[model samples]
Structures are given as structure tokens and as C-alpha cells.
Target: MLLTPFARVIPLPETIMRCRYSVVAACLIASFAATAEQESIERLEVQGDFRRLSVQTIAGSIAVVSEQDMQRSSAQHLDDVLSQLANINFAAGASRGRFVQVRGIGERSEFIDVINPSVGVLIDGIDYSGLGISSIAHAEQLEVFRGPEATRFGTNAMAGMLNLSSKQPDFRRDGAFSATVANYNSWQLSGMLSDAISDQVAFSLTADKQVSDGFIENTYLHRKDTNDIDELTIRGRLLYRHSDQLQWQLIAHAIEQNNGYDAFSLDRNRTTLSDEPGKDKLSSQALALRSDYHGIVGADLMWQLSWLSADSDYRFDEDWAFVGIRPGWEYSAFDRYQRSREQWTLDYRLVSDDQGRIADNTDWVLGFYVSGRELDLQRTRRSGTRLRAFDNNLQRDNAAVYGETSTALSEQTTLVIGGRLERYKDDYRDNGNLTIQQRHSMWGGKLSLNFQASEQAMIYTLLSRGYKVGGVNGEALSRAGDDGLEALLQQATFEPETLVNAEFGVKGAAIDGSLVTRVAVFHMWRDDMQVKGWLNPELGPEFAGFIDNAGRGRNYGIEMENRLVLHPSFTLHVSAGLLKSKLGPYVTQAGLDMTGRDQAHAPRFTYQLAGDWFLSEQLTLQASVQGKSGFYYSDGHNARSASSELVNLRLNYQLEQWQFAFWSRNALNQDRGVRGFYFGNDPRDEYAPHTYEQWGEPRRFGVTASYQF
Candidate 1:
């Protein structure tokens, strides 16, 4: 379907001419504007509790939840609160922390090296996307950024980014504890404390635990559903201010989880039985240090170094025979598979002010990065303890220097130009066998014209380029199909992914800060896209897969976000996104036509709306609704289709030193389906069934109360 703005009454030719004229006029105006002037914007904007946050409403999209919002909710896990976001999707597997899918590209692909996640996650300035680094503790604020961003965050930022800020050490001695009991025998306990060991040194600690009976059914196994989950997290941060110009912090965090291994069964009718009643454990630990310095050659510098380690012990029972004739008939598949990982990263930055020097036309930044990862695995058949050990490692080194400056070309216009040069390398291995070592270097540039159309509004047009690094496949598909399936799984070197993005947008605030709105339209063309594909059965389709070069793709979309304050006690927040993603023609396993296919799991339309009504100074009520209209789960034309709509409600009341809140998700009891496909022994036989289904959560409600003291 072709999507165009609803109010395009003008003819196509005239519209194109008008847009070209506008661009020419904008450039002309920017050329005669003022010279260099230093301008800095705050990094974060905060509203009342539970509302989204951003630095520049139109520059990027950000979602933030302060401590107040965290304390008012009954949610023990971070994903619980994130579920309310329309673009944020999760898949519950054997692990406690669900797989995060943001902006449609995060679904599982056939290649492990191609981490399709366009989103980058950061905790305390440290990137956290390694195995077993999902659970976070005592977060003070969590920020989510959407769209192409490479200037602020180096790489891996294809679609968006997620940054989490931890609570800082308090000079005052304080602590609190809380517990809860809910349906399904669910229970939770949390505590936090902070104190100053000295005037210049301080520290804080936090710990939490959660246990619940999962929501599922298994008639074959008469006990409660095996989706039960238990998780614990601990975190600590120490800050030292040695002198007036320098400050540093040391932080450590850990997570331990024991969960049931469950994958939805093919029983067709029963919604339960999707969860396995098997035991699985996953854990991770990390430590990092950050330093901030002033007066470095008249510039500011920030540096961070981090090291992390993780381990997973997972085992499960699988159906050996195709017939379900016997009772308690179970075959152990991955009787036990152990995985361990270690990673280290170093990041440094330097920022300088122009200050009317060098024609006041220059402002720049210098940055560098180094990261490494290693994985060790041990596996054995469930029926026996004959262990097989394998080792794999990945090392990436990236460096970039970017300088973006806005020279006031005129009083009403600003011209901005910037560029970045980056280089990266990846190395991968299998079972102590080195497969491939690849390296690449790329450069990106950005140019923008910002015009203050009026005091209340600003219009900007930007043309920029961004790149996502390529990596070695972490999990090869060779183990998936077997007998012959493993042979088709081939390991091939991959090239980098790059995109050229063009955007035009407008931003405005009306009614004296009572209303704000922003709209933007963009088109992105990506090259050398790395995507997972199926192999021909003649090659012996098995689980082992290969990484191959995929053709290019194009994405065009529009995004709009608005906030309106109707009264002192009432406010509304709204956001919507429409996207069309299509890949170029490429040869399939059967050599049939498969062009113009939507990227896997990327939705065409997604939107969100919410209203807040403050009943009184001590009480507030909120109603929110979010929906995803169109999504395709696979690249194959015959793959399964999936979509969802969810509504949520929350009420908060505060009195004295205590605060309380009641909240519910999927409040309207929507039926959400999570589907996957399994194609066996049939590449050319497109007539075979290649889809599976598992239902998502139903309506759930809970209340929370917390004491400040």
C-alpha cells in the first residue's frame, strides 16, 4: 500500500517544486546568517512523573521514568514498565529477562553475527548487550532513543538506543525496604541503602528478588506450569571526589536467575503446555569505572572502562518420538549446555568550545573505543554425561572523530555540518576453530539547515549517513536441523551495513508552553544488509546455517508526537509512527521471486496515546492505549502474520511519607499472538505448513505501596 499525507491536495509536480524551492531558500538564508556562537542544550528534559522525557522533542525520541514513577508501580522487573511503550516488544523464553525487540528489527535471525537489533543499551555509560546482561537493578532513570543515531553513540545504533542511569550515592544516610504478595503465589522483596563514608567518598547498595508461578497450563504434566521464574539482582556504586576538578566512580552489578525451560508445544488446541517444567539457570556479573575531568587544554573530557562476565546453565526435555502415546514419556535434548562470556570496553571523549575563536566557526569532539568478547560452551546429550567443550571469541576495535558545529549564518538561520570516520574489525571461531576475521572502515556525514520560521516554531531539514558494524555469527544454524540440516548451514564472511537517511521536520510549542508538537518524514536506503536466509533442501536443509550477502533495502516513514495541556489538572500525550520497509530482489533457496518483502518483524504502523488527570494534589489517574497495526514475522512470503493492541491504566495516591499505586496491563484483555515457523525437509515444497503460534499474556493487575523513610 502507498502511504501519503492525508492533506496533500496539491498535485505531485507542484508539491515537488515547492519543496525544492523551500530547500533552496533555506540554504540561501543560512549562508548570510551570523557567525559562530556557542550554544549548548540540556541533555534531558523532565516533566511530571510517568511522562516521557527528551532533550529536543524533534531531534530524537526519548522515554524516561524517574524514581517517583518506579516507586509508585507494583512492577518488580524493568520490562514490566517498558511493556507499555508501543514500539517495545518482548519474547519470553527460558531466560528471566525477556528478549527485547524495539522498532521491529530485533527478532531472532538465522545469523548470530548479524545482531539485527538496531537498538543499543547502556547502563551507567557502559554498553550491555552481551549474553546474560539483561537484568538491571535500582535504576534512577531509563531513556529510550528511537531512529538513526551515530553521533552520540558510536555504532550498533541502526534503529535506536536505550540508556539507563543508575542512582547516585547520597551524602545522607538513608535506607528502605518493601515486600509484596500477589496472585499466583507471587512474592517480591526489595531494599536500598546509601551513606557517606567520608566527606569526599560515598557509596550505595541495592538488592531485589522476585518469584512467581507462571501463567500457563500443561495437562500432560499435572503440576503447575513450568514457566515459574525466580531472579535476584545486586548493585553497588562508589564515588570519590578527590579534588575540585576531578571526580570518579566505581560500580559493580550482578544478576542470578533460575527459570523453567518452556517452548510452546504444537498441541494445536491447548494454550498451556507451551512452558517446559525443566530447570535452567543464567547469571552475569560486571564492574566498571567512570571519570570526569575539567580544564584539559581548555576542553572537557569523560572516560569510562568496563569489564563483564556471564554464565548460563540450561537443560531441557524434548519429545523424542513423534507419537504422543505414552504417559511421562520424556527425552532430554540439551541435557546440559553451559555457556560463559567475558567482555571489556574502553570509551573516551574530548569536547572543546569555540568561544569566538578561529572565526567562531569550529566546535569539535574526539572519541575512541575498544571492546572484546569471548564465549566458552560445553554441551552433552540429555541421556548421557559425555561432555563436549567448545570455545569462541570475538574482538571489535572501533574509533571515531566527529565534529558538529552550528555556525549562525544569519540571525534567523543556522547551518550545521558534521562528519564521522570510523573503523571496526570482528573475529569469530567455532569449537576452537577460527572461521573468519574481517575488518572495514567507513565514513558518514551530516548537513542540516535550521530556520526559525517564527518565535514559536522551527523547521529543519537534514541529510545524513549512518553505519552498523558487521560481526561473526555467534550461533550457527548447523545444530538446528540435523542429519542433513547441519550440512546446509554454511559460515561465510559478512560485510558492513550502511544507510543514507534524509529527513524533513518541524517543531513548535503553542499556548505558552501548554502544547508541543513535532512531525518528521524520512526515507532511508540501506546497503549490504546482513539478514538470515534459508538454504535449499538439495544442499540438505539442517540447523547449521551460513551468512551470505543480502541485497539492499529501503525504508520510508513518518513520525509525529504531541503533548497538550487542557487544564492544570489534565494533560494528553500522543505519538504515532508509519513505516514501509522493502528489500530488493534476491534469489531464494528455490530461486523463486522474493523481492519487495518486508523486513522480518518490522511493523508498518505503530502508535500510542495517553491521558493524565490529576484528581487532586495527592491523587492522579491515567489511561493509556498503544497499538501495532501490521507486522510480518519472517522474510518468506508465506511466513506467519502478527499484530497486537494493548490498553493500560494506573492510579496513584500519596499521603504523608508513603505512596501507593494501582496498575494493570493489557487492561482490556487483548489476545496477542507470538508466532514462529519451522520448515523441514522442504525447500521447493512451499505447500508445507511453516508456522507455529504461542499466545501472549492476558489481563494482569497489581498494586504497590512504598515508604520514603
Candidate 2:
């Protein structure tokens, strides 16, 4: 099938544009620039006074969450912080927020075999994509990029990127300790210490532990803690300064998790009938080193190297109830999966020094990246006394070279261009003596034009291309037909997916820095879109699912974010996003026409409103409300989640060296669903298809106390 082109843009009403321009003009005329700068001293420092933020993606599409914002929301995990944004969603897999989707594009399933991630995750310069175990207990800032990052991140960043930075070691000794107590038998403890060990070296260490009685209840086992939470994280870093022009940094981190996996029920409630519950355990360790040198022939050079290893044990009950629930039916079943992975990465870059018109007002950057990963996965399925086993080993290697340059065409106009050439290779080997290899070479890049319309306003446009590598399915060998195993393997392989995106945006600070606003419109066209589907044969009870290239698709959206400082002690923030995603003309393997179908997890509209009020020097209040429209769960099914809204509040009291806070999440106790499926699990119904859902967290209130020394 041939790819389809995007439709023409729909023009907006002229009156709307006139009204926006009028508002901008009025704000400019009535503005009074503030001469004095305000600074915050809270643990999660507020960046309200800052008008500009930096991110490593397309210009004007960056969203930054300050430390104070995180604390106000009482964010325990990454999802807690991300939930307040627009055009962003996640799938609740074994744990919370295991997979993230951006702008209606991302992975929705767990990594069962060889797969490529659409979103890229980075923490303190180390890659952690698809591994949501990174602790945010001591983060300094969170930056989210909402479009393809081909030039900087390569194939894995086809959708977007999320970057988290921790507080750096300082010259003075500082430490903090915090504790929290909440409902549902939940509690947490965290600590951080940083000190200057010598004149040339500084060290920092952080640790966190959290425990909670999970929300689900296994009625058959008569226990509420069957699906509980137990997690721990530790990190250490050292910074060494050889001289004013040279520096080196080393970091090491580890995470341990032992969470429950007993989610879902036949009745779509919190109570389950499974007699045998399962566990989700993970242990991971990573190390990274970075070196930087300045004044290298009027340029700067930096190098980074990292290594990571992780082992996971994920098991669950396949049958929702005991054997006696339906006599003479198929016996109960269980599935256990053990996975181990090792990865290594290297990145090096050189940047030219900025010279005032000496180099024609131009700046340039060049970089090279390489990564290697190996995975070993084993699965065992048990049906009563009978057992079936499968095992596979896969290896992936990637290398890329990229370059970008920006030059001033005039005093108000600047042009930027960049490109990346990448090569990817994958090898897979199964225990059944079957082996397959795939290789792909592709190029992607960006072209942008930025115009400074005024001292307080700027507008920009960008055209970018992103790509995801292809792979072969290792599980399809079990269901090979008369065509033989090799032929089936060839049919199971999928090609690479690619997208071309175009965006136009305007950003400015109004009311003399008291207000900041951003508006953007984007359209993306995708080719060889990858989709998952299940196949059942008439000859046997075996069922197989695999990823395939689903012809083409298109997505268009508009996003806006505005922050206004109504007064010195009062602030308001609002954000909204509207999206339309549709699959092009395509025929599925089952001979079904999927044209005009909405993509999975693609919400139509999302919005948020947040406010902060400072009553006194030692007391403050904050509240936020976020909502999302219902969306399809998958491309193969029509099931969807219901529209829902969530409210959160926080109160804070601070004194010299001490802080106390009270926070509530889901204050209304909205029982919204975060994950859903349409597969039958009850034998009493003869395995009929029925919708099952995993609900989001209920209302919870907590108190936190912290001390600095």
C-alpha cells in the first residue's frame, strides 16, 4: 500500500486572530517591567521569575516543571508530575507509568520480544528509556520535549524525550532528611547529603524508600496487601575539577523493587478472585562518567560513557479464578517471565565558541553516539500440571553521527539546520534452534526558521523527520504452519516506522515578565506505522500476537500554555491541548478496513488549571485540576476509558530550617481507569470477550516533614 499525504490545513477564523493580536498589544502598552528580582529558598525552588528555559529538542516546544511545582503536587513518581500536563498519557503495565505516550504516539504494550521504544528517557545524562524506576526524590528540574528529537537522540526518540537533572554538589556542606505518612498503610523516608571533600573534589549521596498497601484486593486470598508496593533507590556522585578549563564527574545509581502484579477482575472492580497472586520484582544498577575540557582551539569538547544492568521477575495468574469456579472447564493457568538486560553507551561532542560577528554570527555543534544492548528472556506457562517453556536472546547495536549549525540571516531572523545518519542492527536466537538478523540504515533531520518579532515576542517554524528501527518476532515460531518456520519468520518481520512533522509556534513574555504564554500547532504524517494484532487458528488452542507495519497515519494538534502572576502572592497557570489522529486507508491481515480509525491512547482533548496563593510568609496554599477526554484502548478493539477529572491540593508551612506540608491527591475519589483490556479470563463464561479495567488511585491524604542541616 502507498502512503497518503496529509490533508490541507483548516484556516482559523479571522476574528480569533484579531482578538489575540489586540490582547497582545494591550498587554504591551500597560506593562511595567519589574526591576527587582525575586528568589525562592524552598526545597523545591520555584522558577517563577525566570522567563526562559532550556531544553534539548525543537525550539519553543519545551515544558519545564520547577522544584516547587513538584513539591506542591506531592509527586511520588514521574507520572504524578506528568499528569498535570496536556497531550501526555501513560499505560499502567506491571507497575505505574511503565510506558509513556506523547502527542498520540508511543508504545502501549510491554516488551515481549524485540521492540523499539518511541520515547527516550534520560536521567543525569544516563539513558533509562522504558525503565520507569528512576527516583525523583531529589531532582532539581524536569524538562519535557513534545516532538521528535532525531538529531540529538536518534531512533529511540521518534516521539519525544524526558530529561531529569539532580542537584549538583556544591562547595558548602548541606544535607536534608524527610519523612511522609499517608493512608492505605503507606509511608516513605528519603535523605540527601552533599559536601566538598577537598579543594578539588565534591561528593553527593541520596537514598529513598517507599512502602504502601496497594489498592487491589484479592477476595479469594482474603488479603489487601497482595498487590502492594515496596521500592528503594540509592545514588552517589563525585565531581572533580582539575582546573578552571577541565572537569570530570562520575555517578552510580541502583534501584530495588518488589511490587505486586495482581490487577484486573472479571467484574471490573478492585476485588479479584484469583487464588494465586504474582509478584513484580526488579533490580538495576548503573554507572556513568563524564569529562569536559574548554578552550580547545576556541572550542569545547565533552565525552560521556555509561553502563547499565537490570534483572526482572514478572509473573501473573492467567486465569481469573480457581478451578472449582467452573467445573469440567479448562484448568487454571499461570505465566512467569524472567528477563535480564545489559547496555552500554558512549557520546562525544564538540562545540564552537560564540564570537560576536567574527564568525558571521554563526554557531555550530557536532556529535557522535554509539550504543549496544543484550537481552535474555525466559517464559514458562503452566496449565494445571502441563507446562510450556520458551526462551530467547537478542542483541542490538546502534551508531550515529549528527551535526547542526545556526546562523543569523538578518538582525531579527535566524536559520537553523541539522541532520543525523544512523545505522541499526539486531540479532535474535531462540531455544528452538531458530536465528534471525536484521539491519537498517536511515537519515533524519530538522530545518527551522526563527523570527524575533519584538523585544518580548518570538515566532518559529520547524520541519523534522524521525524514524524507529525494525525487528523480527521471536514468538511466531511456535505457530508456524505448513509454510515452514523460516517462511513464518519472514512474514512476522516488520519494517521501520517513520514520521515527518511540521510545527509553527509563538512564545513571549507579557506584562513585563509577569506573564508568559506559548501557542503551537503541529501536523505529523507517518509511514509504515507499526501496530500489534492477535491471530487464532482453527487447528489448535495456541494464539499468537505480533507487530506489523500498518500502512500509514496522520496526527494534527494545537497546544497552548499560559502563566499569569495576578499579584505578588497569587499566580495562575492554564494549559490545553486538542488532537485529531486517524489511520489512513489500510487493510488488516484479517481483511478488515481500518480507515479513519482513531489511534490507541490518543485523547481528543486535555486541559489543566492551577493556582497558588500565599497568605503569609510561613503559610501557602495551592490547588490544581486536570482533565482528559476518553480514548480508544487499542487499534484491534473498540474499548475505551471514560472521561475523567482529578483535583489536588497542598498546604505548606515553613520556618527556619524546618518545613511541614499536607497534600491530597484525587481529592474527589474519582474511580477512573488507567489501563483496560478486552480479553476474557473467566472460564465460567466460556472465555467470552469482556472489558476489564485497572482503576487509578483513590483519594489519599498525607503529611510530610523535613529538616535541613
Candidate 3:
């Protein structure tokens, strides 16, 4: 299906796409014919919380993808893992998805201005928000905590949080190496090593490199590597047992991505006509230090310090064709944006010990957080005989203090409350003689009540609030308005946005601990919602972007994650998200009312069902079905993506010290869209509006081999 403003009439063959359903049904029936002994499901732990708790004790949705799951599914990148989860979506305006959205909220992309991410990303305590770091070489688990985590993570986690933990040294001598060869001229090599240097010190190191000639072909330039992928990641860690009363750990990480960025085309297909194909490149390094002290009287003391530095260069061809290809009908232009970013964060916390409780059967925690960031950006544009450059810099600081307390009202009931007080300040400057200063005081809190209905089931209710700081709206506010221009210039900033969430959940196990499930329903209200809009594109860059506050918005959704151990060697998993959203009351600078429309990149439904079957002691098979409903591409345009469906499979075999796996993703070879834009960019049609799209990955097959020692 095609969705456009002027013309929205196009379709792909239904028969070809519908075959995935038949394949799924056949696999399900086949699994039922084979059986093994009953298996007992074990409870997983939540690592990002202030307190150590089981999955069934959480009041909201939490999804954890372990190393075992990644190995069986061949999930080489972070994007691959996100696609298998529920209530989550990512936007890929660049070479890969750097911006993430959870529960119908978050930023899609950033070109000229800085963004405050709604969904936060942290790997081994180093923040990677708004940066796409694809390699997951030695990750132990990826945890997705849905809903507002304001008390725990602050404003950056208004929508949710993605916490990735790396494998720690257990004072053991172990190692592994893996290699893979896949279609699309793709190949990868990764390895991990762990060793104890001394009785008091241990270390673990990981490194990975993946390269692929991406799927797009530049027809005009006769090149197939225009949209290629080249990424490398390395991580090193050291653990020190300072004394029996204290422990310390240090980690260092580095990432380099030199991926090409020539995806969009006039024909809106894999073939492109760009002569000046550009690149999306990044170089980043991070350091993190953590300490845990058990000698602090009646409480356990924990603190972490992390620092990150990144330099990125993103550029693209403004004109998607070679010079003189359309002669007088075309213009030759290229645009680039370069950024240098540095940030550091410190977090300190004290968790109550068994004997530290202020009252009987009660627990408490206190934490303090501080962060500082500096960002510099430069934009270079070359069009026709004109060239221009713009530079800007931003510095921001944040500080917060938070506390949480859990009281057992009775044997079957518990009450939990948490709150935080935060302060934010920023200074902005530009070479264009623009300067702005802003300060804000924000607060957030949560209240949850849990009832242990029975040994196998628990019910809970939660209420939470989250806040995001405001910033300057240079592009939109700088433009001259009618009678409102004077009033707008007086307040050239967009106010901060806030969200209040209410959730109810039930966690239970059935079939004698063989089945475990978590279900949650949440409704969120957005006040003074900050959203991205567009000005008239015909006016060019000086007046292209718009940022403002929408009065009110609402997002409500239901999420479920279930695991069933049908037999000792067979486990089935199902997850889904159903969403409904409205944009609230607002009109764009282009005079378009977006009051009750669905948010951008927000699909109505997403689902995944997977089955793992061990055919024998040495052989296993994994299959899954994943898909999402249709959704709009952006806030200012009507261009939307067609619903998509895919099927994935993997087969594994093992021998002494050696293992081999064959995998296929999107086996049905369906043509689906991942990014879309409705704009007037074509020269032949005199720049008439047209809907354009960037396609997702095609059918892929790969084989991997690994040796463990």
C-alpha cells in the first residue's frame, strides 16, 4: 500500500507476502508433534533497578534478551534485537537507526539542532543516546524497561530505557572466537578473552568488526558500495578486589562507524542516481569506573563515573543526480553536518542492608546524580555557485537528588514511593550572532502498590511523572510571523514537556512454573508536548524546521511478554504491543492543523512469536514471526509506511568445543519500507510533491562458526 497526499495508489502482491503465515503455521504444527520432558522456567533479575528484584516483582513491562537468545537468533546488531521486542520502534534516517521511540514517543532524527532523547541508551554505564552503536560483541544481556523511569534515570528516560550489560570477569580463564560469512558481501569477526592477572585482579576484553556492501546500487555512478556498512567496536575491562570490604571495576570502550549514506532516490527503490553520494561516520570512545563498598556501617555504598567523547560527520547529496543530468531543470548541491560532543556523568547511591532498615520489614535507598555535556556543530552547504557555513555550540549541566522507600503494609501488600528533584541549565551560542540562556527546575516521582494475590501471581498499580527541558526554537522563531511575529520573538523558546503515566499490571506463572507471563496496560498524558514540525520547504533551510509546544496529547497501550516451556527442549515465546495515540491541539507554521492525528513512526500494533526446539542433543532449530502495523513517517507529512511482516529461522549444531549455526532473516523476500518522506525534490516534474521511501533489508542468509575454550 502507498500513502501520499496527492497520489496514494500502489500495492504489492498479497499472495507473495501471505506465504509467511503458512510457514509459521507449519512450524507450530510440527513442534506440537515432537515432545520432551517438562522444563522449569527460572526467574530473571532486573539489573538496572536501584534494588535487586525478580522479573515478576516489577510493576511495569521489562524485557531481557540474554546472550543465549542472541546466539540462537544471530542478532549481530542492536537494531536486530530491538525488532524482536514489543512496544518499541526505531527510525533509520541515517545509515542505521540512531534515534529510538518507545510507547509512541521519542525523537526520530537530528540534522541541525540538538535533541534531548526520550529513550535513553546505556552500555556498561556509558551513555550512547542519539548514537547508533551496532556491535554487541560480548554483551551479557540487553534490558528494556518500558514506561517512565524518572526516579531512577531522570528526564532522559521519559519514554523508557535500554540498558546493555557486558560480561564481567569472574576470575576465570576462558575465551571464545567467532566468524561469519553472509550475503550482500557481508562478513564479521569477533572474539572475547578473560583472564586473572593476579589473585586480586582480573580482566576481560572484547573486539568485533563487521563490514557489508549495503543493498543500494547507484545506477548513475555505476557503484554498489554507495550505501555500505563498516563498523568496529572494542571494549576492555579490569576488576580489582581492593579489600574484602570494597571492590572496584574500570571499563574502556571505542567505536568507529564509516557507513555510507546514499539511501534515498527519485524512483524510491534500491537503485539510486546520486553522483555525490555521502557518508555517515562516527568515532567515539568512553571510560567508566565503578566502586562498591560493603563496609559503610549499615548500608551498602555504590558509585559510578563515566565519560564519553564522540566526533561525527554526516553528509548527503541535496540533489539525487549527477550534474547536467537534467540540465536547466536541476541544481547541483551538497550538504554536511559535523559534530563534536563530550559528556561526563557521576552517580552515587546508598542501598539499605538487611540490618540497615529504619523500620521492621522496610527498605530505603538514596542517590545523587550529576552530568555535564558540551557539543559543537558545523554545517557546510554547497549549492549552485553559492557556499555557506554555520557553526553552533551548546553547554548543559544537570544535577539531581532522589530517594525511594518500600514499606510492607502487610504480608500480602507493599507500598512503594520514589521522588527526585532536579536542576537544569544551558548556554547556547552561534557564529551567526545568536545567543540564548535557559534554566529550569524540574521534579518527578512515582507511587506503586503491589498485592501478592497468590504464590504464583501478583498484581500492581503504578503512577509516575516525567519531564524534559525546553530549548531555543531558532528556525521557527526567527521567521517573521503575521501579527504573532512580535509575540513569538519575545519568547523564542519552546517550553518543556511533561508526561504523567498510569499503569496496571499482572505477573503470573502457571503450569507448575513451566509458563511465565507479564502483562501491562498504560495510559500517558502529555502536557505542553514538544513536537517536531516543518515550515514551507520551498523557503529552504533558513526556514525549514519548526519546534513548538502542543497543548495536550495522549498515548495508551497494552504490552505483553510470555514464555512457555512446552517441554524440556522446547520453549515458546510471544510478545506484543497495541497502541493508540493523538497529537493534541496544534497548527504547523505551514498552516496545517495536526490536532488529532497519530504520532510519527508510531505503529498501532507490533507482535513477535518465536519457538525454539531442540531436535537432538546436538541439534536445535529456532523460528519466529515478527511484524508491525502501518504508521506515519513524520509529523508534517502524510507519507506513511505500509505494514510489514517477516519470518526468521536459525539452525544450530554442536560438536566438541565447536559450534555452527545457519540463519536467515526476512526469508520471504518481502519489499517493505523503513523510512519515508513526502517532499518536492524531483527536477523533471518541476519539484512537484512526491512520496519517497527507503527500503528495509532484503532476504538474507548467513552461516557462523565459533570455538570455545
Best by lDDT: 3
TM-score rank, highest first? 3, 2, 1
lDDT of 2 by residue, 1-709 (tens): 0001212343333323333443344334323222213333112222210112222122547777776768767888887887777788888867566677788888876645567878878877788886764578877678777777888788877877777777677769989999999998999999989999999999889899989888888888888987888999988889999999999999998999999888878768889888888888989999999888885875678888999999999988877676688788656788888999899999888877754223768777788999999999898888789888889898999999998887888987888888899998888888888788989998888888887665455667788899999877766664465332333454558899999888767666653456676666677888999877555332122355677777899877777777788999999988888878888776554455778898888898888899999999999899999899998877766679999889999998989889898999889989887787766566677767777787878898999998988
Model 3 earns a TM-score of 0.92
Tens-digit lDDT track for model 3 on 491-551?
Answer: 4677888898877666776525566777776778889988887665363222355567888
Candidate 3: the clashing residue pairs are none
lDDT digits (tens) for residues 332-376 of candidate 1: 233456777787888777766544223665455566666776656
The residue pairs that clash in candidate 2, if any, are: none
| Full ranking by lDDT | 3, 2, 1
Query: Which candidate would rank higher by lDDT, 1 or 2?
Result: 2
Estimate the overall C-alpha local distance difference test score of candidate 1.
Answer: 0.60
Clashes of 1: 20
TM-scores, each model vs. reference? 0.82, 0.91, 0.92
